[model samples]
Every structure is written in C-alpha cells, then in structure tokens.
Target: MTRGFADRIPVHIQQVVEAMVEVFVNQSENIGNEVDYLQVFELSVDTADFFSMQAIAHSREEPPYSTTTEFVTDTAITEKVYIISDDYGLEGEVITYLLASEY
Candidate 1:
C-alpha cells in the first residue's frame, strides 16, 4: 500500500500551509465583480483533518485589496463539504461590490 507523508514540521508545514492560503485568496479574487458565482478550489495538498486556518481581507473597496484566509488543522468533511470563510457573510466592503451587481 502507498503511504502518505505523515510528518508536519513547522518550517515545511508553514510553507505548505501558506501555499494553501494563497489558493484560497486566489479563488476569492476570481469572483471579481461578477455575481451569482461560485468558485471552487481544491486544496493544494491533501491535508489531514487536523488543519487550521486564519483569514484576513486587506481592503473592501479596491482592486488590490489583499485577503488572507487560514484553515485549522482539524475539520470534518463528510456528506456536503463545508464552505467556511471569515468574510463570506456579514455586510462588509465586498458586499458592496456584490450588491452593485444586482440591477
């Protein structure tokens, strides 16, 4: 049987985790000014359920606003996949962009 890499050190893990966060950010930006859109992103690597995350949006009303989203090391994924985001909901700056799309 083929075995997966099971050891996660701080240095290597940091790099890998950062890469995953980048994926999330990219997916978020892919939404752009479009509405009624769904962007899906498969993780960079198959992570164990024990992963963690942290997310931050740099700006709300600008093109170059940066958003950093993190994931925890432990999450359950069964049946329907959970789409968790720090700013997915709530009336934030991004909301304006999405709302404007409604005409």
Candidate 2:
C-alpha cells in the first residue's frame, strides 16, 4: 500500500511552511499596537506539488477589520507578507493562498 501525496507531506517542507508562518507573525507584531496580533488558522496544503497552502489569519484591531484573499507565489518571504490592507499596514484579517511551486 502506498499513501498519496496529500496524505503524507515531507517533514522538511512542513517545517518550511511553519517557518514562513512564524515570520509572518513576527513581522506583523513588529509593526506596532495597531496590528493587535496575527493568528494563523485553517492551514491546508496540497502535498501533491508541495507548493500551495491556504491559511486564514485573524487580525483583531480597530474598526474596518476587513478580510481579503491574496496569493503568494515563488517569492522570498519578508515583512511585506503581512501587509494586509492599505489603511493599517499589517493590521486586518486575511486568507492567504501561498504557492511555492517554483521553490
């Protein structure tokens, strides 16, 4: 019997994903109190390509705390990843779809 790609993702790849999330959280925190905080939830990935993951980030702060979806693909992970909205910089909730296929 063999397990499918989606059933068993490589440990190292999972670690990389975790690291990316950590960086996002850290960067969001460094922004300021206006950010409140960033939390990652509902993290799902397609291990078939080991290149995509959908995560929901809940950011609690001021009013107009909107939610949006963004796709990140084959790009270096930086503080910019937490820039959810133009109004508050790293403040606001969002669902991020990340694709690292090229990696």
Candidate 3:
C-alpha cells in the first residue's frame, strides 16, 4: 500500500481488500500453477450514494466482464483503482496493494 493511500484507508475499502485477499489466497493455495501473478481491480462508488460501492477485479482470461468479485459497503472513501500483484523477490511471494495513480 502506498503511504498516501494508507493514510486515508477507510472501512469499506478494508472490507473489499480483505475480500480480494481471500480470493487471492484461495486461488494460490488451490491452483498454484494456474493462478495469475498479477490482479487488477477497479473500485467505483456511486456518487449519489456514498454508501454503495462496486469493486471489479479484472481477468481478461475469464471473459464476460472478467470480474472476480463485487462488494458494497457504507463509507465515504474515494478510492479509484488499484492493483494487487505478486512480487517474488528476496521476501518470497510478497503481495502489494497500491493505488493506480501510485502504480
């Protein structure tokens, strides 16, 4: 997570990130060889209703929107887009979550 994004983390964003991490972990554990090392997510909130939000994790390999999950929660955080990817460096499989702008 970027320092800027981390400073303003919101509850709703927390929920969505947690959900995405669950999916990532499950996929890695159950289908290690077939899992994608990189995952991209776009988070858009309803301007009229801040309480509602939609998060899309795109995987063009899975057509039909390629969306992995969608979630809704109540909050006023304005996260635009972010990506979670695996970086197998000296730290082993280190996963990172950062804003698109930060990317």
For TM-score, the strongest prediction is: 3
Query: Residue 34's C-alpha lDDT in candidate 3?
Result: 49
The lDDT of each candidate is 0.32, 0.37, 0.57
- Show the colliding residue pairs in model 2: none
Model 2: per-residue Cα lDDT over 55-102, one tens digit each: 333333452243323343433222112222233456854533223221
Cα TM-score of candidate 3: 0.59
Deviation in Å, model 1, residue 27 alpha carbon? 0.4
Candidate 1 lDDT tens digits, 1-103: 0011112223343354346545656665688642222222223323446454323222222333334344444431111111223345556423111111122
Where does the lowest 10-residue lDDT sum fall in candidate 3? 58-67
Q: Whose lDDT is greatest here? A: 3
Ranking by lDDT: 3, 2, 1
- The lDDT, on a scale of 0 to 1, for candidate 2 is 0.37
The TM-scores, one per candidate, come to 0.25, 0.29, 0.59
TM-score, candidate number 1: 0.25
Q: What is the lDDT of residue 14 in candidate 2?
A: 40
Which segments of model 3 are wrong by more than 4 Å?
28-33, 47-51, 54-65, 68-72, 76-78, 87-90
Error of model 2, residue 22, in angstroms:
0.7
Of candidate 2, the 10-residue stretch with the lowest lDDT total is 76-85
